[model samples]
Target: MKVLGMLYGMAVGDALGMPSELWSREKVKSYFGDITEFLDGPKENDVACNFTKGQFTDDTTQALLILDSLIENDFIPSEKLIAEKLIEWAVRTDAFENNILGPSSKAALLAIKEGENADILTRKALTNGAAMRIAPIGALFSTAQNKELSEYVFEVSRATHTSDVSIGGAAMIAYAVSASIEDKSWEQIIEGALNIYELASKKGAETFTASIPERLKLGIEFADLYQDDEETFTQKIYDVIGCGTMTSESVPAALAIAYYAKDPNRCALICANIGGDTDTIGAMATAICGAKYGYDAIRKDWIDTIDSENSVDLKNYAHFIELHKPQFKGV
Candidate 1:
């Protein structure tokens, strides 16, 4: 049930924030005020303007590709297979030229299409695309040891985002989601995520690593302040940590918000209201919160809305993850 929550939570957050992605905090406030429900992307939104209310964007769509690839390959998709599926999805969904794909993913996919090695092409690319689609990997491998989990995170992320920064962001989200699914305490989850981030930082991009611990600590501090004055809290987050698409900024922001909110709906709202990269941040935060609180934690209305709008089956993805979970040899 919680697994279902994580999957649906991703879509719910993605849909709720779709309209606001790339908007500035001031612009978002001027327009939507505060996103409490699904809304169509603004006419000015170049990428998402074509989407209807309650329709998820590339975040969930790409995630579903990862989910399908994982299930079809029995939990371990090679880089080529993952690249093929991503390209296939882009073409099939007409995202190839729709300005829908992220810069890093678009470049990597193009490189793959041109016969470059997926891993080599993405080695320098760093974006939230990998992290946005990483919840399923976390949920499916919740019980694996941290070392094993980190390895899997690397393998999955390297298919399209090879930067240590990007991989670290994805690993942090993955470990947090996994820990939440295992019902670990919030402290434990945070610590586990930090540990994964530390390890991942050692190998890849070194840009964001040094500041993560401080950012996370700041998030906790702000969470305490959030209860006193919501407006000030939001402003503080915007001014300090940011809500942009950079893996460093958005990933930590998502973790902080999820840690602060601890509830799926509130997490989604916080991410949605923060502006840039709203859908991706909302998806990451709400997925972790959903893992914590279960599917029932999400608003019934939101679930119904997403179900009516999107074509993919959330439960089917969850079921496939469950069915394809790794079988440990000497557990």
Candidate 2:
């Protein structure tokens, strides 16, 4: 149930935040007035305008690509399989034509289509594209298997985003989810994520991007400082931590907001309204939230809506994950 909870939570968050993606925090507030329910994307926001209510954006789609690849590979993370799955999804969904794909992923996949090596092509591609679709990596690896987890993350994420910040942010989210699946409290998950971030950061090629670990620390501080002022917490996270496409900003913002919300549903709500890259942030954060709380914590109506509205069967993904989980290569 918990394994499925992680997937459902990611989908829920993605849909919850779909309409608000790419909008600034101020614009989100001015236009939507803090998202409480799923709404269709308005014509004003170019990135989100095409999506309808209860529809998840590319974040969830890409996450499922990873899961599908893993399930087919007997739960082993294969870079080649991941790349192939991504290309298939992009073409099938018209991701490139629709402008739904993230910038870094689009560039890398395009290079791959031209027979260029994705590893080299993604050398400087630093964005949350890797982190946004990384929930499965967390659920696949255990907290103690940091070495294996980092290797798997690098292999999968480097196909699209190769920078230290990008890979590390993806690992950070995965590590937090691993901790959550182990029933760790949000505090423990935060600590575990930071520790793994340093290890994972050293694996990828260094880039000019800001350090995800350092920004994550600041996010924690921001979370603490805003405890007495819950009303301004989202705004503070938006300004200081940011909710941008950069791996450094969105991943840490997701982690901090997840910790602050302390519940899957609340995490979805708070992140949905946080503006810039909201769907990615929400997907990442809420997945971690669900790992801790499991199925019972989520509302039944939300589950039914996500099942009916989305294309993928979240339960089938979860079932496959659970069935093959014993064969996970992370350990």
Candidate 3:
């Protein structure tokens, strides 16, 4: 159920926030008034216009790609296969032609498509493209294997986002998901995320980006201080913590939102209305909440909507991850 929650939570959040992707907080409020439920992607927004109601974006697509890669290779993933899969997806879905690809990922994939290595393009890449799709890595491995989990995080992320900032952000989210799935309290989960981020920061090329761990700490502090007021909480998240494409901005913001909202559906709903990289933040945050709370915590209507909307076999991936971990097997 935890695994299912993580999987479905990612898609649910992604779909719920799809319509408002990349809009400003003010723009989101003005256009939709308030996103209480999934709405059709407005033609006015550039990236969001590609999607419809209850449809997820590249965030969930790439995550499921990683999940399927693991499933096909007997639960082992190789960098080569993941790259191949990304390219295949890009070609199949015309992601390059469409506006679905993230900036960092688009650059890296372009290099790969041109018969070149992605290292140069990825060397300075720092965006949530990696962190957004990293929840499965958390669920597939337990928090006890923190070192091993960080290594997998590097492998999974280095293709597109090779900067230390990017890897650290991705590691933070992944550890949060793993810790949440293990039923750790939110406090302990934040501690684990900060620790793993420090370890994972040493894996990739260093960059001039903001520190994800430090920003995550700040975001959590904001959450704690603004807990009593929804208006101030969301404002702090949007204006101060930021809701941008940068891994450092969005990843920490997502973690903070997860800690603040506590509930999966609320996390997604808040992200949906908060604007600016809404789908990615929602996907990352809600997945953590879902892992902690289980699938039952999610709204039944939302679950059915995701199932009916996306053809991706979320249950299969969830089942595979559940069986992969020893603790969840035969439950």
Q: Pick the candidate with the highest lDDT.
A: 3
Q: lDDT values of the candidates?
A: 0.82, 0.86, 0.88
**Deviation (Å) of 255 in candidate 1:** 0.5
What ranges in model 3 sit over 4 Å off?
327-331
Please give the RMSD of candidate 1 to the true structure: 2.1
Candidates 2 and 3 compared: the better one by lDDT is: 3
For model 3, what is the alpha-carbon lDDT of residue 94? 85
The C-alpha TM-scores of every prediction are 0.94, 0.96, 0.97
lDDT of 3 by residue, 14-89 (tens): 9999999999999999999989998889999888887889999999999999877867876666777888898899
lDDT accuracy of residue 175 in candidate 2? 91
Candidate 2 residues lying further than 4 Å off, grouped into runs, are none
Clashing pairs in 2: none
Candidate RMSDs in Å, in order, are 2.1, 1.4, 2.3
Once model 2 is optimally superposed onto the true structure by TM-score, how far is the C-alpha of residue 147 displaced, in angstroms? 0.6
Cα deviation at 191, candidate 3, in Å, is 1.0
